[model samples]
Target chain A: MTQTIIWTVAILTVLGLLLALILFWVARRFRVEEDPRIDEVEKAMPGANCGGCGFAGCRAFADAAVKAPNLDNQYCPVGGDEVMQKVASILGLTVEKKAPQVAVVRCNGSCTARPRTNEYDGVRSCRVKAALYSGDTACSYGCVGCGDCVEACRFGALSMDPETGLPVVDEAKCTACGACAKACPKHIIELRNKGPRGMREFVSCVNRDKGPVARKACANACIGCGLCARTCQHGAITVTDNVSYIDFTKCKLCRECEAVCPSGAIHGVNFPKELDKEAVKKRIADRKAKAAAEAKKEVPNG
Target chain B: MGKLTFSMGGIHPHDSKFARERAIEQLPLPPVVYVSMAQHLGAPAKPVVAVGDRVKVGQVIAEPGGFISAFIHSPASGTVKSVAPRKDLAGNPVVHVEIAVEGDEWEPSIDRSKQLVTAIPDDKAAILDRIKACGIVGLGGATFPTHVKLSPPPGKVAECLIINGSECEPYLTSDYRIMLESPKEIVVGAAIMQKVLGGCRCVIGIEENKPEAIRSMRAAVAELGYPGIAVQTLKKRYPQGGEKQLIDAVMRRQVGSGGLPIDVGAVVQNVGTALAVYDAVQKNMPLITNVLTVTGDRIPGNLQHNYRFRIGVPLSFVVEQAGGIPDTAAKIVSGGPMMGKAVSNLDATTVKGTSAVLYLSEAATRRRPETACIRCGHCADSCPMGLEPFLLNRLYKAADLEALEKHAAQDCIECGCCLYSCPAGVPLLDNIRQAKGQVMGVIRARAAAAKAAAEAAKK
Candidate 1:
């Protein structure tokens, strides 16, 4: 019995040693050489895996950062400039700083402004509703108000406002990951520079119908009268398809376009409220006086 | 009798058909009608008439927008009040042609006589064109254009034409009324469709609960001496009228995942659609009217009505005619309770596929609180498509798109059986429905990508 036990133990030990040696040889033979800097770059990454940098994840971005000739087109939007700079230093490359962006809902057609023409009773998804037909409102271009963006946002930056029937973005929590923008079926969400002091101006209406039709559908719809575009001194605003767009890069926040907008579609948020009210009132008075003078001149001609 | 049923999973729900015995009544024309342009599944028909254009009944008011679209005809003779966006059955905004009723004068080409024209034309193309011209669609709730369904893709030969007389949905008796009242017309319609399908054998499948319909249809088939046409009685089951389920019950063939009924040499048409086809081919009449049942358990006895209403009539008007919205009604469904959509806005009007306006009381529609799943597999047993709803629900919660596709999420038919059968009151169908949409979108994107790659390779 003692001799059999000794033989069994020796044979088992030999098999274990042989397998370990083979495993070691295979590990070395098929070893893939990877850059040591990739691990450091990944460690510096925010690890959100939000895919805001057009990469699958932080590890994927790190791999590409180590292999790419230069970090020209590669930048993490979530991390802004700091993470990209760290990655660039680790990779011995350089990356240009890009302006931090936040998603902004481009529609201002509240329930009170744009009355619901019908009710949507199908799947409670904005994408599904958008695919089915126009929304409950007559303005087909407005938000469907189904909270699909809120559901898609991993950072909890969006929530549907019950009163306005629109999504509200929390700038503090928003990483400008572009998930909400991509999830928007109507293309109603846009990523723009957060602006100084979070002050931003944009045309809040997406309706492209003619003036009369647009006005009939939503009270705050852009009529494409070109008044705001003409009023912008810096040429920051342009009207196309009966809708106006504000170029944030060129906008001076002068509030001229907002004052001149007849439908109140051009909106400026986080600006000085008292100054805005005063300027708006003054603009209205000036418009009324001009119209009266023109009418008087036409009457004399008649 | 050993009744025929689909071999897969199904459920037995209470057939709350309170208005089954009531005969169909003719509803008076409303003051104004809102005829939606998108009553069918495809692209909305483009408006052919302006706001102030005078339109006669049976006149084409909107033209088909695409190959799969159907034409929209004026259901009433009136002056067009407005052509603008209006609310549909589910309260979604859809472009509608609003007309103020002036008179009920129909187009001159329509034959208004009460004679039953049993002789089907030999020209198949002419029959299909006439069906399309009349805007005939599957009235069994899926408003697929009949013309497109009749003409299957090449290499697919329809060996059997299944007539869905199985009004299996609880509280829906429009098809039953059609079968009992217009048996001759239905038989002739089936014969016409069989002729269109190259002399394919026709089978009219009705649920066993609808004995009167089966008797009447069989008698009609015998009287007409229609060759290659027969009547079948199916077991009373929820979703038995489902196109796939019905095909399985009758043909004993399972339609493969993501495949149509024609893939198995069969074409199924609703009995109402067949009746519409008869009118379209023989009488040269358009589908301007349909039968709808308006019933509620809490409603007064006299208030439950089965009306043959004209298309484009406001549902509110019909409800008011029945007894003004019942105080007990907590939810109003556009179709039967099992598959119908909740009426979010009553201002929405009826369409070509409107079969019933069901009102469920608060007690009846109340949902039980969801609890932890016990792995009971009841949902799996109840799913008519043999899908594991509980597993799908879990995968959806995990947002595992890859696993969802592997499990064939797109095969879900959105039938409420899993939800109804779950002992834990889990919303299996709801979660699965959303996941199905996501999986289908992914599949479509992948297909498009592959197509593009193939094109590039060819170049």
Candidate 2:
């Protein structure tokens, strides 16, 4: 038994030495000479491999950052300007700050204004729907109700209001990726300036199909009759190709476009001052009275 | 030869090619046509003709506004009634030249004969010029100008060219029909593309279901004795026709995240593109019309018709020719069921990118209720471009542009693969698209700023 134990020990020693020699050979022959800068830059990176920097992964981005002359436009959205500065410092380049912006769906063609016409029966895809034809609604310019915009959204910023068949974008969740814009063949779901405090006023409808056709399609389709431009006190609106476009930079969030739009094509978000419900009621009454007065005027002056 | 395939993230939807048996037929010309100017994927074309001007079929009405844009041509000889804005399929009122059709008179320069011509252009510049003059854009639903794709940007070398014959979308067999009927045209077109791309190695990729097409394509390649240009059979998968996917399958090169196929030393052309190239280089014919499948036979009342239509023909008119809407047809889509747009207006005219018009019965198109993301990464796993759709969806919900860019949400191809694969029917792509635009905007602004800084430094 004692002899057998010693023999076992000797065999074990030989096996251990063989394993050690194999390890040593592997370490020496197949060693990786990784540049320390790649590791350092990678450590500073967001490591999301989101390809926003046009690289496959964070490591690749780090390598690119090291090789590039500057981190000029290579700001990582996840990391923001602060993370970019660190990367720039490592690369001996300067980084600049950019304004944070989110995606804002301009239109508000909800179920209240935009109603369904025919039902769609195919692959429940926005792209397929958009590729096939206008959606299951009278408004060819509005959302297809198929959720292609929602499907296109990579940032979960947009959602379809099941009650409305229109997309509702969460301002805070939006990342301005433009995937939805490309996905939307109708191009109604636009990514506009988020602006300060999420208060923005822009022409929501993209339908430039003239007054009569636009009116027939959607109750709130933009007529593009230049009423919004005329109503804008700040010369910030432009009328071209039967479409009204508002310059958000120049126009303050006055919501005049919303008030003046005959079809309510212009939309607003987060108005601080509560809209006077009584005033709106009064205005509608006054407008009816004015219409009655105008009709009376149109009658022969007998 | 072994069957080849583009790797990863493709679905095999039902190939409901009910109209496959139908031979290509010419649709009766409508009394009126509204021709769109911006048919290609670039700047909107500028209208050169005015209202009240008489024009012939295939006559240029709008000129290219940019290098990437294509010129607009009249589909029929007619008197220009109104050069005004008309609602397109997407509800965008583009500049359309409204023509009151007179007759089927074509432009005098065009040879209307059905004789097959095999004259190849002598030089690369001549071929490119011919293609440009023809206004040949990708007939594969992309509408990218063929000349632009053939002519790579300066310093970028195109080592390989791929012919995309994979008609991966279900119910759309336009390319398949072309391959089966006119294999020679496709082959000649491919050879022309190879020549224009400076003799790059070319491969024709056809799906396995199309053995007849593959055999025909292979036969055409052999008889032609075109060295390096070969045919490859791909696994049938939805979106296999996608340029990136096709390139990957053929070259085994992942076009890199946020990079084009051209970046990987490959230029992928669609089967329709090859036909257009052949027409441009060999026949000197411009791209004013294409083949489209108007299918719905499986549908109770839908017509299954294969049509060769001119650009700007109204969907209403096309549907009317296909025995009108199936009395049971609920929705009229402009393309295949998988990626097609549901058009509300039949008045909207066909553009260059139109492939098929599907009138799905109510049973085929009722969208399922959208539910919460059950953390099923089907969207991510099925994404052709390798995007984390769930993560993007979350960032989009938060309006976290920084997180979106950090996650590389901008790389999404918007192919609806994520949305299609979701078991819970989550609209992952819809929300992501908005964020994508915003991120792209930020990127563009940064680029502009960098450019401005660089110019300032130079000064």
Candidate 3:
């Protein structure tokens, strides 16, 4: 028994050593000389694999970054400027700081604003619903409200608001990954630069029907009356396809377009709401006081 | 003898033919008709008449816009009220010409005589032109322009003219009623199509369950003595009336994937389309009216009817004529239950392809909760195209377009057989249909890119 055990041990040890040597030689022969910076850059990434940088994954972006001469156009959107700064430091390169973006639904056709003309009873998927027909409302180009974007969101940044029957985007959690924009069948969601103090102005309507027809469909539908375009001194607003679009790059955010919009379709987000309420109340009180003074003077004259 | 069916996969659903015994009735002229610009597969027609213009029945109100589109004629003599966007049966807004009916005078060119004109013109071009001018389409729910189908692409020869009398979709009896009531007209239409195809052998394929239609068609063929024309009985199965399945059943020919029926030397037309062709070729009539069945199992027997209705009549009017929608109805379909789309808006008017208005009760239309797939292969077994629907569903959920293309998701006919046969109650066809659309778009884009590259290289 001792002889058998000794033979087995000796044979196994010899085989293991031989295989280990072969593996070591093979590894050396097939070694692909990759830049050591790739690992460091990948480690700096958020590892979200969100494809927000137009690459398949974090590793792919890191590979491209390490190989490229300069990091002019490449940046990790999920990790934002901090992670990108870390990556740039490791690569000893500079990246242009890009303004952070968040997805905003361009449609404001709430259930009350755009009444449902029909009821859909098919698959409750926005893609399927949009492919079959327009939304339940008369406006053919509006949010379908089927929660496809909610389903597409990986970060749980979207939810269907029961009161409005429209998708509500949670700006805090939104990475501007553009998954919702890609998932929306109507192309109603867009990635806009998150402005200073998260205050921004945009047209909340996408209806492209002629003025009267669009107004007939939705109360808040933009009629492309050119009022907003004319009001913008910065030439930021342009009407195309009977819908007004505001170019964020040129917008001064003066809120002139919002005041001049006839349909009230232009909306400003993250602004103080109490100021408008106070201004309206002050105007009403001034009118009432003026009327009372005029009545007293007329009674004395009679 | 072995049962006759398509070679691969099929399912046997409950017929639910509640209106089988109902006789065809004629619906009165609607007060106002909303004629859609898009009644066929290709580009929508362009309006030829403006608002306030007077039009007679069968007058061309909208002209065909492309090579594969059909003309849209006025269904009733009326004055055009407006040409604007209106809701279609699926609630999609389509350009429609709303006309207010004043009278029922038809165009003078149409032959209104009761006599049957059996003599077919040998001049194929004239026949095709007349068919095009008459706006006759398939009327089998596809509404493919008949003229385009009759003329196959160059280098392809039509071997068999198959008349589809298989109304396999449950609760639809319009085709059956047409076969039983006007068999002679249908046969003559088949002969005319055969002549157009240069004397191709014609076979009328009817389901065995529709024995009355089979007997009538066979008797009509025998009495008429139309050479090279015969009637064949098909086993009852869902989607048997599909062009590919009918071709396979009648001539044992399989249409290749992404290929037309002409590729397999076959030209398939519906029985309703055959009658329309007869009207267009022999009687000089444009397609203005279509027969449709309004049926619900919950409805009283006397209320169920197969109505010969003019195109552009609101579905609400038809439902009212059929004694109103029952309270038990939870869903209303524009066609049969299996493949028909749910009617979302009653104001949306009927088009040329409207065959049956089916109402499903709450119990019948209730969807069961989806469970995990046990890999029973039922979806594959029931797919007429022999496609793996469950696998396609998975790939669709994964958003893997490359794998979807490889699995031939574009070949799905959207027959709903997989959904019907799924024991797990999985919505296989619903997901596959969406995937198919996406895959088709990708394939078209790729083809366009290749063509552009080839052109650039040549330049």
Per DockQ, the best of the predicted structures is: 3
| Residue B144 C-alpha lDDT in model 2 | 88
Model 3: how far is B420 from its true place, Å?
1.3
When superposed on Cα atoms, how far off is each prediction in RMSD?
4.3, 12.2, 5.4
Docking class of 1: incorrect
Q: Is candidate 1 or 3 superior in lDDT?
A: 3
- Between prediction 1 and prediction 2, the one with superior DockQ is 1
Worst 10 residues of 3 chain A by lDDT: A273-282
- Residue-wise C-alpha lDDT for candidate 3, range B129-207, written one tens digit per residue: 9999999999888999999999998999999999999899888899999999999999999999999998999989988
Best TM-score among the predictions, by candidate number? 3
Error of 2 at A24 (Å): 53
Off by more than 4 A, model 2: A1-209, A218-302, B300-302
Q: What is the per-residue lDDT of model 2 for residues B244-354, given as tens digits with 9 covering 90 to 100?
A: 888878888888766877888899888888887786677666787888998853564236878888877898899888887777676777887777777766788988888
Which residue runs does candidate 3 get wrong by more than 4 Å?
A: A1-21, A66-75, A81-95, A111-122, A136-139, A209-234, A239-242, A256-264, A273-302, B1-3
In candidate 2, residue A90 scores what lDDT?
76
Model 3 residue A87 CA deviation in Å: 4.7
Task: Give me the overall lDDT of model 1.
Answer: 0.89
Better of 1 and 3 by TM-score: 3
lDDT of 1 at B435: 88
TM-scores for chain B, listed for all candidates: 0.98, 0.96, 0.99
Interface RMSD values for the candidates, listed in order? 5.3, 5.9, 2.3
